[model samples]
Target: MFSHRVAALRPSPIREILGLVDRPGMVSFAGGLPATDTLPHPRVDLDPTTLQYGPSEGDPALRAVVSENLRGLGIDAPPERVLILSGSQQGIDLVAKLFVDPGTPVAVENPTYLAALQTFRFHGAAFTDLDWTDTPAAPLTYVVPTFANPTGRCATTAERDALARACTDGGVTLFEDDPYRELAYGPCDRTPIAARMRGGSWIYQGSFSKTFAPGLRLGFLAASDDLFPRLVMLKQAVDLHSSSLSQKIVLDAITAGTWPGRLTDLAAFYRRRRDTFDAALHRHFDGHATWSPPDGGLFFWLRLDRPVDTRTLLPEAITRNVAFMPGEEFYAGEPRLGTLRLNFSHADADATERGLRTLADLLTEQ
Candidate 1:
C-alpha cells in the first residue's frame, strides 16, 4: 500500500488534460509549455564525454551560467548557492522536503500553480491560500510573483513590498517561483521579493524551460545559506544530479551570447499571440468575457461575464474538437466558477486564431 501522503494528493489536472486532448484537431493550451518552434538551435554537438554521469551537483559551466543569470535578478549568490534540478517542479519538491514537515502550514497564492500544489501535497504539507482581506500575518508563503501560472498576473511593486514586509515582520519562509520572469511582453516595474527580503529567509526558483527549452529540463534554485545544503541533499536523493549533457548544452548556448536575443525574440512572438487572442476574444465574445492583459508569459486568465460551469463545459468542448484544463484545479479551496486559463504560446498564429474562435463558440453555446 502507498503512504498516507501519497493517498492524500489528487492527480495533477495537467496530466489528466494531457490524456483528453490527444485527439486530432484539438488545440489545447492547458500546459505551461513553450512552443517547440521557438526553441533556439535545438541540437548541439558536444564531446561524448559530457554525456557520462556527472557530478551530484550540476556541472561547473552550467552552474556559472545559472549564477550569472541570478545576478541579473539582484541575488548576489555564488555558484555554491545554486543547485540545479531536473526542472523547477523538482525545485518545488526539494523545497517541500527540506522545509515542510507534515501539517506545516504553508500559505500559497489563492490560485497557485496546480502542479506545485500536487508536489507539496505529496510531501504532506498543509496548504492555506492567502486571503488578502487584510494583510496576512506571515508564516511560510509561496507565490509566483511574475506572470503567475493560471492567473497570468504579475504582482505590482506595492503588492511585492507589502508581501515582503509582511513576511519579514511575521518571520515567514518566502519561496518565490519565478519561471516566467523573462517572458515579459511589456515593461517590468517591481523589484523581486527575494531582492527586497531583509534576513535572507527567502528562496527563489527559476527555470530555463520557458526561456530556452523545456526538454533540456534545466532549472536552478537560489536560496539563503541556511536552506542551501538541505536542498542539495534533496536533489542528491531525487536523481543524483541534473543531466550533465543538457547542462553543457545550456552552458554553451548561454556563453554564445544568443540566449538573450532568443528571449527577446520569444517576447515579441508571444506578445503578438497575446494581442491577437485578446482582439479575437473581444470580436467574438464582445462584452461577454473579461481577462487581464498579461504583461508576460504564455497564459491569459479569463473570466466569463456570465457564470459558466467549466466542469461541465470542458468535456463538451472536447467533443467539439476544442480543449482546455478547467480553472477549479488551480485553487486550494472552493473552485472559481466562470474562470479559465488560456495559453497563447504553444500554438502557431493560425492554429491559435482558429482555437480561440472555436473555444468562444463553444463557451457561448454553453
Candidate 2:
C-alpha cells in the first residue's frame, strides 16, 4: 500500500509532541511556534493580480526583497538567483530532492534539526559527521548554524570560519538554514558561512516565518549557478510556486518599511521570555544538567548530568501539564539520551518557571 520510504518513516518528535502541548494548563516549551504578539498583521491590497497565479520562481518583487536581505547578510545574492519557497522547510525538501539518491552520502550536524533528519532519511541520505569538517566530506551538507532549533546554539565566528573553509576546501555544497539570524537579543554577528564561501558550491536558506508571518509560508534558498535552475524547476513540480497573495503582503510590508523594525521588535519582545527561560535553567538545573543560556532564538538545549533517557520523561511531563522535546530526537546518528530542548518565546514568565521546575524535579529524581 505504501512505498518503502513511507513504510519506515518515523514521525517527528517535535511535531508529534505538539498535540499534547495545547491541552488546558499545559506549559509547553516544545514547539518553535512563535508567540502570537510578535506576528505582523500587514494589510494586503488584494487586486486580481494578487489572487491570480504567479511565477513559479515567486513574485519578482518579493524575490528582490529577499535578494536585498541576503546582501545585507553579506551574501552577494542576486535577485535572479533566489528561489522563493513555501517555507524554509520546503527548501530542505528541495535540497534533498536535488541531491539525495538512495544511500547517497550526505552529512549533517550531530544534533541537528528534526525535520531535516526526517526529510533526508525519507530521501535516503546517508549520514556523515554532517557537522562541517568533523567527518569525511560528503557532496551535500545541511546545517542551521545560527541559533539552531532544539539546541538554540549559534556557531561561533571561528567555527563558522572553519566550516566555511572546510566546505569550500572539501568541495561540499552547504545548505545553511538560517531562519533565526534576526532574532538575536543584543548585538551579535549573524553572518552566513556561505558569505565567505562565495563561488563555492553552496545553498543559503532563509525564512519569513520567524520574522514576518508563518502563515505567509515564505522562505528562500540561494543556490549556486549549477543548482539554482534545478531547484526552481523542482519547486514548480512541488507546488507551482508559493502563494502570490502572501508574497504581495510581505512586499507591501517592506515597501511601507515596517519589516526591518518588525525584526527589531521581535527580538525585543522575545528577549523577556528568553530571560525568564535562562534564569529558570540556571536556578533549577544548574548542577543537575548543563545548558548554555542562549543569547537569542527560541530554544535552550540541555544535557542532563545523568544518562537518563529524555524520551521516557515526556509522558510524565505531559501528565504534569508541561512539555518539551527530547534531545535525542534531533540527532540523525548516535544520540545523547540525556539531552532535551526547551522553547521560550511561546510561553510567558510563569509558564517558563513552572515548566522548568517540573522538568528539574524529574531530572533530580533521576
Candidate 3:
C-alpha cells in the first residue's frame, strides 16, 4: 500500500503529454525543453577527484561559480550560502520538506509551476493565491517572477520590491524559482526579490538546466543564514551529493567565459521561435482566442474565446499529430477549462507553425 501522500499524487500532466508527443510525426509544443542543438558540450579537463564522491554541500568550485552568477542578479550570496541540488525540482522538494507541515499555509501564483504545486502537495501544503503587488500573510510563498513557466509573465520592479518588503516585514519565506530569468527577450527588469529583502526572508533557486543542459541535472539554492544550514542537511539526507562530474563540467564551462555568449545565442534562437509561434497564433486564432506574447521564456498561455475544455481536446490534438499542455494542470486550485500552455523552445519554427495551425483547425471544428 502507498502512503497517503503518494496516493494523493497524480502523474505530471506534462510528463504524460510527452508520451503522446513521442508518436511518429507528432509536432510537440508540450514540454518546456531547451533546444538540444543549443546545449553546451564543453570539453573540460576533469580533475581525478571529479569522479569520486563529492562534498554533501556540493563542489566548492561550482558553488563559487553559482555565487558569482547570483551576484550578477544583484543577490549578494556567498559560496557558503549556496547548496547544490540534483535539479531545481529537488530544491523545491527540499524546501517543502523543511518548511511545510501538514496543512501549513503556502501562497503561490494563481497558476504556478505545476510540478511545484505537486511537490508542495506531497508535504501537505495548503495553497493560497499570491498577488505580486500585495503579499498574502502565509508562512511561505513561491513565485517564478521572471518569464514564469506555463504563463511566461514577468513581474515588474515595483512588484518585486513589494514582494521582498512583504516577506521581510511579514516573516514569510519568499521562494524565488528563477529558471528562466536569463531567457528574457530584451531590456526587461530582472531585479530579484532577494535584493530588496533585509534579513533572512528569501530563498533563491537557479538552474543550469535552462542555460546549459538539463541532462546534467544541476541547480543551486541560495538561502539566507537562517535557512541555509537546514537546506544543506536536507540535501545531504536526500542524496549525499549531486554528481561530481556534472558540477566540474558546469564549473569549467562557466569559468571558460563562453557560457555568456552561449546564453546570448540561446536568447536569439528562442526569440525567433517565439516570434514564429506568435505569428502562427495571430494568423490562425487572432479573433478566435486571446493570448499574450511572452517577453521571453518558452511558453505562450492561451485562453480560448469560446467555452472549450482543453482537457477534452488534448487527445484530439494528439490524433492530429500535435500536442500542448492543457492549462488545468498548472493551477493550484480550480481548473481553467479554456486555458492551455504551448511551448515554443523545443519545437522549431516549421514544427511550431504546423502544430499551432493544427490546433487552430481543431478549435475551429469544435
Best prediction by lDDT: 3
Q: Please, what is the TM-score per model? A: 0.94, 0.95, 0.97
Candidate RMSDs in Å, in order, are 1.9, 1.7, 1.3
The residue pairs that clash in candidate 2, if any, are: 107-130, 108-130
Candidate 2, 1-366: lDDT as tens digits? 888888878777777778876789999889888997877777666788788888999889888888997888788689999988899899999999999988988888888888988999999989987554453378988888888887777788887888888877778888888989888985555888889885678899988888778878888888778888999989989999899887887778876766667777788888888887788788888898888878778888888888888899898888999898888888888887788888888888888888889988887766
Q: Give the Cα lDDT of each candidate.
A: 0.79, 0.84, 0.87
lDDT for predicted candidate 1 compared with the true structure: 0.79
lDDT of 2 at 29: 88
Give the Å error, residue 31, model 3. 0.9
Stretches of candidate 2 above 4 Å error? Answer: 131-136
Which of the numbered candidates is closest to the native, going by highest TM-score? 3
User: For all candidates, what are the clash counts?
Assistant: 0, 2, 0
Query: Of the pair 1 and 3, which is ahead by TM-score?
Result: 3
C-alpha lDDT of residue 191 in model 2: 86
lDDT of 3 by residue, 103-184 (tens): 9999999898999999999889999999776767689999999999889998888888888887888788989999998888
1 or 2, greater by lDDT: 2
TM-score of 2: 0.95
